[model samples]
Target: MEFDLSWILLGLPLAFVLGWLASRFDLRQLRAENRQAPKAYFKGLNFLLNEQQDKAIDAFIEAVQNDPDTSELHFALGNLFRRRGEYNRAVRVHEHLLSRGDLGPADRDRAQHALALDFLKAGLLDRAEEALKPLEGTAFESEARLALLAIYERSRDWPQAAAITRKMQASGQGDFSARQAHYLCEQATAASAQGDEATAHTRLTEAMAAAPQAPRPRIELARQQHRQGQPGAAVDTLATLAAQAPGALPLATPLLIEAAAAAGRSAEALALLGRHYEQMPSLDLLEGLVALDRASGDATRPGRNRYVEHLAKEPSLVAATQWLATEQLEHEQFHPQIQRALDQAARPLMRYRCAACGFEARQHFWQCPGCQTWDSYPARRVEEL
Candidate 1:
């Protein structure tokens, strides 16, 4: 049992040598793995900066595989997939991130938001709504609510849209009173279509109270009153609209003139319209005045004279054509053809144009069909603008 000390000392050095070699090997392997991960990540970033998305995606996938537990890499890859319109892949990536037990609260919320965006981009409204609901009180709450509002609007769910607008208003996310009024107006329109005058009236009244400065509510309310055999009330509502939002009077000029005729208040309507035209010389206002003048049997300030007056103020092809239509030309044989050509040229100038997107329409729209922007079209026509 008496062993030699030489054997013990010899075994110790050999074991130490093996341990050092193994440590060096492990260090080299770790360094190589770290290098590969960074190399792939930087390569992906370079590809992205160069606008080579496909190559960037391949590099990102390689980077993610090399470092599977990296949350940032997962986010980048998920966002890239979403940008590429690969919603299914984006959803999977974000869902996998959400499923990870080690992920932090913020990261989980981000993943949830990303998943919601993927659903929204894929035109899955129901799924997007479901995914976005849990993000309340988080940093992504505002964005989620806006997306939800847009979805509700797209689906014509005015009540939901109004509720979201209220919440956004309470949170100091800018004034949404205008939008709230629009929603109520939309709801009122639907009610009126279904022959529910009481509900429509209530909604329109609420809309006016919600945003008195908003022109759409008053205009809609006036229309409702006029349709319900209350022309006097309609005139009063429109008069209030003109006083409150003078810029919007042109949009309701025809209705105003009709209501004035129905209510037998042509003199007051003429005065109000003339004052407005004096302040703002819109073609619509001029047309309203001319219609009332022609109907009044007053030869002094004739309807055609107003066109001549408008021409003196500003050169308008529309005004010139209207004035010429009543003139006794020396060469009257081709008058019809000349009138037709002039009318055709003047028609486009009478169309309204959207301020936000430059979309033109023969009739004004509260919301632009082209850009989906509310109150984009001004009351003035393309010529006036």
Candidate 2:
């Protein structure tokens, strides 16, 4: 029980010295680990900047292995895999990140988004949809919903696309009324093809109601009415369209002529078309005017004469061809060859072209096949545009 003062004093300093040395060792170890992680990351970044994706991937893998807890590095690696078209590896990396309990809520959401992107890029739409569903109510909700909408559209799932669009509209994404109307029109088209005229009519009516100013719904509804042997109703629908969406009358010209003739309202339809042509002077409108004139037996200026009038206004090859078709050349024997050459030259000008993607087609499309853009194609023909 005797106290030793010297030994007590010596032990105190030794304990202090040991504690200081331990702290120094820990700091040095931490600095070394940090340096190693950054070295690998910078190597990866250098490789990426140099366009050496293979080496970049290798370096990123090394960095991830060295700093397993780094969520940012994991994300980078996952993205690189996806960019390289290694979707499986990208999916696995993101899934691994999700499985880790230490991940934060934000990181978990990010990883889930990355996994969905991987599935989408791999063309596994079903899996992508499932993965994207959980992102609702999160910060990534808008992005996920947009992806889902695209998937539904690509699959031609009109109802699902409409539902997603409605949600987007509700969330203040933008006004999707026109797009919703298009979906209903697509549904009507399918129903009509299946011989469900009643359903098609209902859907077309709903489409018209959804977007009163949209031209497609009225045009489609009129077409459906005409097909169902209701020419008078079709004429009425087209007349409303002419008053409200007159800019789109050219696209609906042929339909109008047919409906007018069937309903015994050729004169009224001709007057409406004449007014539109006076304002816009579209070739389609002029063609519609000529058809109606011929149908009504106009003697002063025949259908073919309208072409010469159009040629006077616009120096169009299409108009020239139409005018020449009705003319009797001095060398009547060579008329056929001349007409054929002119027709061949004017054929391409009749095609509709997309303003967004520069895609040309014989028929106008509400959505572009090349770029999947809605209302990308103008109603005007290539020459007119």
Candidate 3:
């Protein structure tokens, strides 16, 4: 019934030997796992470099399986899936990272951003918006705000777009004053459509105050004034615009002529247009001058003569076509066919073009419908460019 001291001494050494063996086995296993993970990672990288996305994804999945705690591997896998248009897989991977309680603040934000990108790429706008809103004060704030701005613009949510632009302005991201003006103009258009003329005018006024240098609000305001039987007000607005943004005179010329004719100030409008045309000879300005001269009963100089005069400044096909219409031709019967061909050739040259994306349109745009860029289209026409 006595404890054996011999047994205790024997067991102590035996236990130490067994513990050493187990520790050695664990060390070997850990080394093997470490080597395997890196091997898989490098294999994935090689596949990625070779542009074999499918193979790279397989390798990355193997690496992630080999090292579940490797956040970088998970990120790579998620991004690969996202790029491969595997939104469900990308969302799941990012969501899994977010679910981990051991993740640091920065990694958590990254996971959230990745999740938002997945939703955005998948066209799940509502989900993307929900995911992105949480990244407001994070490092991804600017990118998130821009993405949100695009979403609002695409959806035509003017109020939300305006709010986002204001936030971007306050953060010193960029000057969104012009964009803010566009949003107000959009709101004004909506108000005008609803027969709320007072509200429309107020919004347009706010828009003009927001970006005094912007042309859209003033142009829109003038159009509204003309519609409301305020021709003098419209002419005054366009005259101010011509002074402020002389380059935009081409776009405003047609409106100015109409307003001036309505207000009985055709002579003053013609002088203003001529002054700008002298500085920058725009086809639109030349056309405006011709229209005004013809309307004023000035037979001393024909409108066709203005096209001939414009030809002296620039070799415009449009101008030549116009001049050919009234010129004395030896074969007057063939003039119709020749003029038709010239008109067809000059029509495309008369289109307004986007400076950003090269999207040509018959009319000028404040924003590019193709690239979703604001003020991408120049004030001048394609031929002028």
Candidate 4:
């Protein structure tokens, strides 16, 4: 075959031109698709900023359909569904992401976390726990463990909570000793309620060993001792607590007074309480002092007069009520009414208040019932606070 040089030269440039034209057309098409994706994404963002969650979800859905490979958009849409309380839809989206083989490790972990959140929001605690378990070796380990701990606490699984706390402590998540002690105390309380005094005693001992500086263990242990007819041991325990955690002495004052009376250690308890009253002058400690004085056969006037002294230091209505309760009024007939009003006024002030959630209760709580916060209630009464 004869070669045609002119034709060959012309064909080479024509083919080159054709190839360039096709490449340009493909690039333009890709650019148009990319532009549509961002337009939908921005529309979703605008709707979200406007708090139109339904519209935002629609826009995001459109964006996701346009760019099916976009992991970020999928995550955003899933989270929006979760925020809107559409747990089922959120779970589906995150599960879809997880099913994708093309997803990176980080995205996979994020999808898992999002799925767990959906389950948690839906109150599917079992599923949530299962989802969170896999995140232990991942970057979300701390957060997942914390969530797990909360779940265990809410479920009253003391042993599980303690185990999680131990792991957190071992990981240097921060000192969880106090929390661990609380868990042990919770276990002890359950055991005591079930009449397992031996188990309760062991758990309480463990709690005290876990956090020696914590006042709850010592206080609880003393109460247990008193209940077991070991008033001397109870008094000794409270004395140790008063010496170590003096600020918590007010919380232990009533128990200490009872223990002292039972153990014939009134003089020693009186001296200890008097020393604390001099330093801090708490209403509870003052009450303890008055009780001890009365028990020791001190003069009636001087023993009850501590309330008047407390009133001199603090303008406390509770103190005034206490003082008036023991006083001989000039208008004796009207004294009952006045005392009743004062007593009513001081009743609310005697409540314990949660520092974290402002919840008030007649008795002290180591954990807040309102917000499920631990160690939120201070050892002082509301009026004292």
Candidate 5:
């Protein structure tokens, strides 16, 4: 039987030609698509540089559509959407990247992080937390933990914040002792307010153990003790604080004096305050000493002499005002008005100021309200600073 040799020979060339044409067509299409993708991407970049964000986003979306497998394009598109405040679109872009089976581990993490950021920016805290939770084992672990900490803090979930901080501390990220102390102090405050004195005491004690150098715990514990009619214990606690955290003595001084007077330990309190004044020479310490002296009916020096001595050392307006307030002026008629004005001016100088953000407050804060920085406020007053 004739096997159609002629047809086979003819068909072979035809098949080869068909294959070649098909291959050429495919290559052309691929090159055209590749060129189109870059063209769109570059157009987007140009628009972005020109501050035409709307146009840039359109171009990026086009590029992403043309090059669906391009991770960089997806990232660019996601960021663009986020920058445009289109969190939903940003989330979609990042989520799509995360869903891809061929994504690298690092890229997967990046996508997850982007998704979290989108949710956070959109004020979707719950979704953001969920997105950030899986980032624990990735390079984004520290960043995710920090974000999670912020979330918990904003929600006033102290327990969760403490857990994250402890985890971060254990991982050697940085010291979170002070933050932990603050969380415990917050809990203590709440417990004390609820009439749970024992729980408050326990929490404050734990806070002190967590960060001995932190002043809030000791101060709070002493206040609690004073409230519970344990003024002697409160004075003892404050003395311990003055010894352990001397830089915080100014803040503890008034409380210490109150506790000492209530506990009939004015003599001991005066001695401790005098010692602190000798070492630190703070106006608050001097005030504490004077108050204690008056309460004990002991005149170590004239009540105004301490301010004079402080003025000689520091040239402080606050000190000068204190001295003048107690002095018999030649023009005594105007003294009251003058003292009131001087005191008003000095009040602001006595307030604490945050070093990081220049936020001024009457009380010293571990965190700056303006910038949310921890340990931003110096121990010294605005004038001292």
Candidate 6:
């Protein structure tokens, strides 16, 4: 063993030389691959900037093939495919990323999100839901839940929409109380249509509790009570509506007057009507007041005179038409022709217009039928706005 010391020293130097050569060989191979990857990547970037997406995709695919473990390049390719409406290709690229065992948690979540988006854009909602569900506890949770909420809404799955909204509210995404109230209202309406009065009542009550300041639930509940032969209850509900959400009273003027008359609450009704008219004069409210006054037959002021008074406050063609129609003209021969022409001109002015998209309808909507926006319509008519 002592005689082999010189041989051991010589063998150590030879082994070190071989090791160095092997390291250099591996580094050269890695550098060559890295150089090819960047060149392909830059080519892809150039094509992308030039708006040559198809060529960019080809270059990106080449780059990804050269650098197979590059999560970023795979993401870029997947997103580019989606932007080009090549959803199948995007899904494939993302699916590949998800299948890789070496992919980090963040990249895996990103691929899952991309896959869901692909399915959503392609109208494969069922697939999208499956893809998005696993991302619930990830950083993509909020966005995933929002997408799921939209899916449920589009499918008219009110229960699912409510569940998602509750979760989002719990997460402090924003106050979803109003939207949850709307969901309950929708469920109530559906229950009412199906002759499930008890369920409808419960749902409407929940909606009211969910959004105490929301006017629709109270209004709807009053209608339900009136239909169920509970005029007293209906009147009481409307009284609460008048006190709590007075800004919405004009829109419900006719219903309130009817309910009040049914319950024999004329004095209370008159007081509420007068207060609303004084604050914000609406043509509908004025008409309701005239009807209530006429019904009471305790008319201190003429019912038609309210129209004239409204005209004094605002140069309303609608009010002028109403006043003139209620009067007998001395020139009776031309009165019919004048009335017909005025009515024709005022017809369009009575329609409700969406403030968001400028779409007009003959009736007011809580949600804009044109733009699908909630509470976009003002309580006032087109002429008032």
Candidate 5 lDDT score at position 334: 92
How do the residues 1-385 of candidate 4 rate in per-residue lDDT, one tens digit apiece? 9888999999999999999999999999999999999999999999999999999999999999999999999999999999999999999999999999999999899899989989998999889999999999999999899999988998899999999999999999999999999999988999999999999999989988999999999999999999999999999999999888999999999999999899999899998998989999888898888887777777655777888888888889888888889899999999999999999999999999999889999988888999999989888888898
Give the clashing residue pairs of candidate 1, or none.
none
TM-score, cand. 3: 0.96
lDDT (10s digit) by residue, model 3, range 1-385: 9998999999999999999999999999999999999999999999999999999999999999999998999999999999999999999999999999999999999999999999999999999999999999999999999999988998999999999989999999999999999999999999999999999999999999999989989999999999999999999999889888788878988999999999999999999998999999998999999899989989898888899889999989998998898897998989999999999999999998988888889988888989989999888888888
What candidate 5 gets wrong by more than 4 Å, as runs, is: 1-21, 49-52, 296-300, 328-337
Tens digits of per-residue lDDT for model 1, 113-134: 9999999999999999999999
* Candidate 6 lDDT, 212-282, residue by residue in tens: 99998999999999999888898889889988988788888888888888888977888889988898888
The ten-residue window of minimal lDDT in model 1 covers 376-385
Candidate 5, pairs of clashing residues: none
lDDT comparison, 1 vs 6, better candidate: 1
lDDT of 5: 0.89
Q: For residues 1-385, what per-residue lDDT tens digits would candidate 2 score against the true structure?
A: 9898999899999999999999999999999989999999999999999999999999999988889999999999999999999999999999999999999998899999999999999999999999999999999999999999999999999999999999999999999999999999999999999999899989988998899999999999999889889988988999999899888889999998898889899888898999989898998998889888887787987889889888888889999998899899999999999999999999999999999889999999999999999988888999997
Clash list (residue pairs), candidate 2 = none
- Kindly report which residue pairs in candidate 3 clash with one another: none
> Sort by lDDT, best first: what order?
1, 3, 2, 4, 6, 5
| Candidate 2, position 116, lDDT | 97
Worst 10 residues of 3 by lDDT: 243-252
lDDT of each: 0.94, 0.93, 0.94, 0.92, 0.89, 0.91
What number of backbone clashes does candidate 2 have, counting pairs of residues 3 or more apart or in separate chains?
A: 0
lDDT of 5 by residue, 234-313 (tens): 99999889889988888888888888889989888888888877887887787777676566565656677778778788
Alpha-carbon lDDT of model 1? 0.94
Where's the lowest-lDDT run of ten residues in candidate 5? Answer: 292-301
